[model samples]
Target: MSIAETASPSLAEADRFRATLRNHPAGVVVITASVEGRPVGLTATSFTSVSLAPPLVSFYIAESSTTWPALRRAGEFGVQLLTEEQSDLADRFSRRGEDRFAAPTAWSRGPSQVPLLDGASAHLVCSRFDTRLIGDHWLVVGEVTRTLVLDDPRPPLVYHRGAFGGVSALR
Candidate 1:
């Protein structure tokens, strides 16, 4: 391969790629897992349902994420769907070295010892199915063990163009 073909990507190119993806709106979720009974989680917009018979779900996390280290040790995880009103919670979880569980963030430990945040549109308990490295991120697949749905009909949070938003009916 030519030197240019094998060369590292430019920062501008990476930025442009990110910007392009921002145009495609994605649902937001907070991936929670336990490390020695302590809860850890991070905001992710890449969560997606991958299968039915196997009851699989998937999400992507950056390889450099500090939380991923502990989360990997977790045999299972909790995927909580956030509502548009929970934007502050999403922002807090995205940051590093702070108490994400503290302040306004309400949550309780599940029977499996995973932290389940309050007010989520939906919640799912998942067994660590598998993980694969893709580019600079890890694609995590989880097998859903249990699921919950709230009676409240709140609009789930969506991320687009570098901001948080909710859905609206076109019809």
Candidate 2:
């Protein structure tokens, strides 16, 4: 622990830490995989590009996530970069024990059969590059083998301070 961490500890401090992180904006992402012949998915704001030369990206999943166990078994998955108009999808995918793909959730199988959600700003077909346990979450890095850029002109979905919003460029 850091010297400061060792000196004082309380739920107040944890709340402060959580709020501190919430203030930092993060791009929202959705992960999709076919587990045991069924589709599985979850929403996340932890996605980031890790490398350019090798085309790598990463996101973190909570260890307690009930969906992670099945998602891990799939050798491949799809990453969807959500647009501001897709918060409904983000909310749906974040929940547990529900049919996330139930009616009207437009999607189709990729060349490799990974379930890819339609209307995302971008879609990436990823194979496991690495996985590690960190704190209470799983850090997953994926090597992108294929990608698609949709022609949608909507702003990207962004999360900050517990709410979702879209970007407006500043002059």
Candidate 3:
């Protein structure tokens, strides 16, 4: 049967799906942008590279996100890949009703005035390429305009089983 014709999953099934996916690991990043001349950002594990030929990336933001209203207005944004050491920073941005760019948080403005988080393993400054409503979230696509790489040797952060962690070389 077609997806639209299928019955919606029960709440228990949905919870099971969420629990099952918790075993899968995902890289962490902070998506930032400036709106009304002020910095705004949020932690995201949905960030992923979509293409290499044209240097594109994509992430999903919930439609109910409080930060989405301001973030949607920006023509450009910054994506900072977090290191394992920045789990607190990740936790900070993921929270609600707080000044995410306060004194303790280090950051600077970059091209197009996008807010760039300091001490990240890498940063990607991107121009909004496309955005569309998909289910309950917006799928945002960006074209990379600039990239900054740090010399830090720390492993990139990842989230799995509802906890932040670093990876070890398999080989």
Highest lDDT model number:
3
Q: Candidate 2, residues 24-134: lDDT per residue as tens digits?
A: 999898999887779889999989999998999999999999989998888888999999999999988987777899866888888578888878999999999999999
Predicted candidate 1 versus true structure: per-residue lDDT over 1-171, tens digit per residue: 776765556656888888888799998899998889789999999899999999999999999999989998999999999998999999999999899998778999885988999999998999999999999999999999989889974998999898899999899
Q: Please give the distance, in angstroms, between residue 111's alpha carbon in candidate 1 and its true position after superposition.
A: 3.2
Instruction: Return the number of clashes found in candidate 1.
Output: 0
lDDT of each: 0.91, 0.89, 0.94
- Sort the predicted structures by lDDT, highest score first: 3, 1, 2
lDDT of 2: 0.89
Task: Give all TM-scores, in the order shown.
Answer: 0.92, 0.92, 0.93
Q: How close is candidate 1 to the true structure, as a TM-score?
A: 0.92
RMSD (Cα, Å) for all candidates, in order, is 2.7, 3.6, 3.9
Q: Candidates sorted by TM-score, descending order?
A: 3, 1, 2
Could you tell me how far off, in angstroms, the CA of residue 15 lies in candidate 3 after the best superposition? 0.2
After best superposition, candidate 1 residue 87: deviation in angstroms? 0.3
Model 3 C-alpha RMSD to native: 3.9
